[model samples]
Target chain A: MTDLLPPIQTTARDDAVLKALAGFVRQEALGPGEKLPTERILAERLKVSRNTVREALTRWEGLGLVERRQGSGTYLKAAVSPDMLHMPLTLAGGNDFAGLMATLEIRRALEAEAAALCAIRAGKAELAEIERKLDLMEEAFQTRDGMSSEEDWEFHQAVFRASGNPLFEQIIAAMYEMFHRFWEHPLGVRDFGHASFPYHRTIFNCIAAHDPEGARAEALKLIATVEDDLKRGAANLKLSDRR
Target chain B: MTDLLPPIQTTARDDAVLKALAGFVRQEALGPGEKLPTERILAERLKVSRNTVREALTRWEGLGLVERRQGSGTYLKAAVSPDMLHMPLTLAGGNDFAGLMATLEIRRALEAEAAALCAIRAGKAELAEIERKLDLMEEAFQTRDGMSSEEDWEFHQAVFRASGNPLFEQIIAAMYEMFHRFWEHPLGVRDFGHASFPYHRTIFNCIAAHDPEGARAEALKLIATVEDDLKRGAANLKLSDRR
Candidate 1:
């Protein structure tokens, strides 16, 4: 049982400090412009050196977890995702909505690569995994009469894993995790096909058949379809404003 | 004199601990296969409690700076890139190559956003700054009759700033700092229009006109052109194989 929990076993004093700080901020539901506890008090409470506290603070800074004031203590800034994709966005210090769109563009590129590589790299085991995710997604689509957000994510994650590149695998994972809110808080019902399954199936087919061009085409078609929705949605807002 | 030193000003005990460990690691010139000092000896030499040392080690783990094994002490891992672009390809991770191409593809998406935003958001001050860079680039092109890698970077740096989106601005700054290596390192001698300045000017011209469509087109053309060069140069083994 102890060996099974290697991930959280030690958790390290500094990591504990960070996790504590994050949890406090999260539970309070702070946003940008919120204040955090003073380092001296936190240091005393955490029973670690101020130096150790400072390192944890730096981790928060690197993650865009807080806005530091030179003479004042750090304040909570953006709410961090419970996922890794948001880590790089924060690590890169991008917060604006336009920046989020830029992140999506990056995803487009990775998804294309994922499709192409999945075509070549995915073996029978990986193909079976993709097929399993596809079936799960289809079931979610059928039962929910809409794509469950979690199911949508599971399908993408499967593709990334199939790419045979751990870096791409993890980077894509981090990105999806970071953008969980945008996905979960749907502006409208997601189009599973007309609304999800063919794009998924087409991508899966290309991978299973080991056809790179077909995979790339299918991936682009998926992104293009989504971008179309975003465009129409933006236009509809303009029309509603005019009315 | 103190200011000339690295940013290690907080506490001597902690700084001494970190610096000593850094020295020990450097002595081994640690790489992927490298092993590091044991916690017992490291604590003894640093004159800190094992708990304090463990906290410091945890900080390194968070940054992916070191790895820990169940039976073994922590091993030295590579540092993350400060200049994100020029980051050596191997830093993409020893085990992943296809992932790297996908990552570059992602970067291109972010770059396109920066260019498009620069078209809309740039002010007169920004345009003037871009023009100033253009002047220097012209000087390099006309007088030197060869590449001006420094000027080449300055031009793009100006464009990222012109975007008025600090998120894109800083990202491009960091990424290009890494990409600048290709300018001086390999002389593919692609030619004037094909090289940096001409394409940059075309991009500059579109942005100056506030033509978002034109700007995006120009930005993409320049990127596609370079990507072609990257693909060709890597294939020909002229760009270090990017392997």
Candidate 2:
């Protein structure tokens, strides 16, 4: 029975303080615009230093959970519901497989839209940069031994830039970082047998032709290929576990 | 001509240090596995303290631009392309219209998928919770209010939770916070004549029937309504400007 138990995960003192403060607010049934105890009082009640309380309060304020009046005191500005407290998408450090899959799905949606937008909005300079990247990719395929993840990343990034939406670029960049850090293989790595070049060419052609729907379709197909690779990888892990 | 120019946005010393380091790396054309200069050397070259250099390096590491090896120096682990440096999605503070629109489009994509997933995966308790939230929404519509943003928020949050992917919930929560902070009107606010209640009811019916496509369609319709409202609001602003 003891062996079957899950390992205990210790919470940091600061996190504990934050939880205690959040719990206190819940227990008191604090509503929006309601005043919270002063830092000194919260510190005394929670048995933590005033600095710890202040730090937690600052974090809460950033999360829009609380508001601090300069001359007055901190007040509850938003009702921190149970669902809000259970937010699991902290892109802090490290990555889990499920989180990676979730991120990939998000990428599928955003990148498809980005490709469509790029087809509509890309200027001559932006289109030339994308063409340059594709040419570099072709060169790498011909000269180098394998596909270069760096070149592949640049190609996609160029498309994002051409989308003219900074938000898409930023989200894609963050997702790329997370995927790169977590996966054992670098992003955009195609196996020797995987004919990914044709898909890239198709996507490029769509953009070059200024076909938004076609670009979107090609992007989705590309992501679906990546998804299939991930699923196969996961299946292999399960097989190894059984063996 | 100089007076006609926009005011310069002052860069903080730390941000300036960070930018300078990034610029140095770019100018040097640093590639993967290339070791950076010692902290002492970097600080000396950048005309900043070692602590500032360390701080900037730490930020770069978090952004996945570099890697620090134990017993060895920090090395450039990724190609720092110009586009990589121009990532615009800062979920920091404040709200810009373009950012909000980007977030809304992302929401449309993710939430539609989430609703579909909820229809397929939601357990009994989760389904019950969704029903309860819908009931609360109806009550809000019936009495005490025209349309409470809080109730609307909770209703959508419940659907996200029922989707069984914490990633969806977290992303939605972050977007909600951003939208809430920036938009003059709270998220999901509609005019009394807008008749959003029927759409919510339709979504709930689809989820109850486990119709993934129906749920998705209804979710898309809801987002489309919001998008139309946003477009109208923008048009009104332009007309007012003309007036």
Candidate 3:
């Protein structure tokens, strides 16, 4: 039972400090705009170093949990409640087929919207960058037996950025990294279908043509194909492992 | 000129080490399956403490950049290129009107998809949790002149979780946190319209009925209202500042 519980003290001292401070705030019933104790005081109360407390506060500031005013003191920026304390700000990095499928669903939503937005909003520089990434992907396909997943990833990232929404780029990049953790082969390998490769160019053309609906349709079709391919790949990998 | 460059040496020693190691990988043109040098050697080369090196490697493992086999050495799981090193996995935390609007665009994409998925995949328990969150929001609305943004946030979080897609929940949570950093008032204030408050029940009813299309349509309509209200709020805030 003890092993089942996570060790409160570990190398992740900053994370531990974050939890401790959150607990302290909750116990005190601190509300928004309420000033928190000094870093030194928090360190002493938590029996940790001042640097650790500072690091935790800095992270909290980034998460909008607290605000540090110059010389005024740190204050709560939002209400700290029991449920909010444990809300993860990133993916839990699950390594399973279902996790992969769920991530793809998110990608489908993001990618389709991104393509439409890019069609309407991509600037000349952004469009040029997209074209450059596409050129690189084409080169890789021509020269290699298998498409370069890295190049393919870069192409999609370019499209996401062209959407002019940084959140889309950030979230999709994180998903790409998380998928790499458990996938045995490159993610592109699972992207089956001979027509899938050319769809990249078609999607690009829609964006360049400034056809938002066309771009959205093409992106949706592409992801739907990738989803079918992923199902097939999962089954094949399962059979091979069993053999 | 010196001030223009970010200090390579800072309290974020682990991040510096990450950059150093990524540079080393690129210089060596290391590909997947290539083994990295021992920690001691890497620490010596980078002139950092062994602990820093270990922390960097642990972070890299989490990012799926490297894999450490038990009793063996760390190996590159994917190609480390110039662009991959600079790619940010989180938002840059822009504090401006355009940034807020951009984030809302992402929310629209994720929220619509999540509501649709929740309608199809949410279990009885998840549906009960969603209803419970709605009850809390309704109670808050009944007692307060202004809606509680926190309650509203919790309600949306429950819906995201009910989607059975952790990515949707994680990404949306990050965006919510990012927006809070700069917004002067509660986010829910921008959620205008009498119909808007009632839309929550409509959304919940759609999900409860297991009507994915209805849920998706309602979610999109709600976000569209929020977006328009946001534009109006921005104009009002600008006018007030001028006054």
* Top-DockQ structure, candidate number: 3
Per-residue CA lDDT of candidate 1, range A120-173, in tens?
888999899889988988888788776455777788888888776644555555
**Candidate 2 local lDDT, A1-243, one digit each (tens):** 114475576645556777777677789998899998998998998888886676566556544567888779999976664323221134321244555677777788778878888999888899899999999987887777555556777888999888887566756775676666544353333462154556777898999999998998999898887787776666555534320
Where does the lowest 10-residue lDDT sum fall in candidate 1 chain B? B82-91
Q: Which pairs, if any, clash in model 1? A: A84-A174, A85-A174, A85-A175, A86-A178, A191-A195, A192-A195, A192-A196, A193-A196, B86-B178
Which candidate model has the greater lDDT, 2 or 3? 3
- TM-score of each prediction: 0.50, 0.58, 0.62
Scanning candidate 2 chain B in windows of ten residues, the lowest lDDT window is B1-10
Candidate structures ordered by lDDT, highest first: 3, 2, 1
lDDT (10s digit) by residue, model 3, range B1-243: 113464454376777787788788889888899998988888998899886687677656644567977679889976664334222233332445676787889888889889999999988999999999999988887787445567777889999998988778766765676556534463344444433567788999999999998998999898887787777767766745420
Clashing pairs in 3: none
Please list the residue runs of candidate 2 whose C-alpha ends up more than 4 Å from where it truly belongs after superposition: A1-94, A182-196, A239-243, B1-89, B92-94, B182-196, B238-243
DockQ (0 to 1) for model 2? 0.08
Tens-place lDDT per residue, model 2, B12-91, is 54456655655666677678899877777767665676765665665565444578665688998666533232211334
**Candidate 1: how close is chain B to the reference, as a TM-score?**
0.57
- DockQ values of all predictions: 0.05, 0.08, 0.13
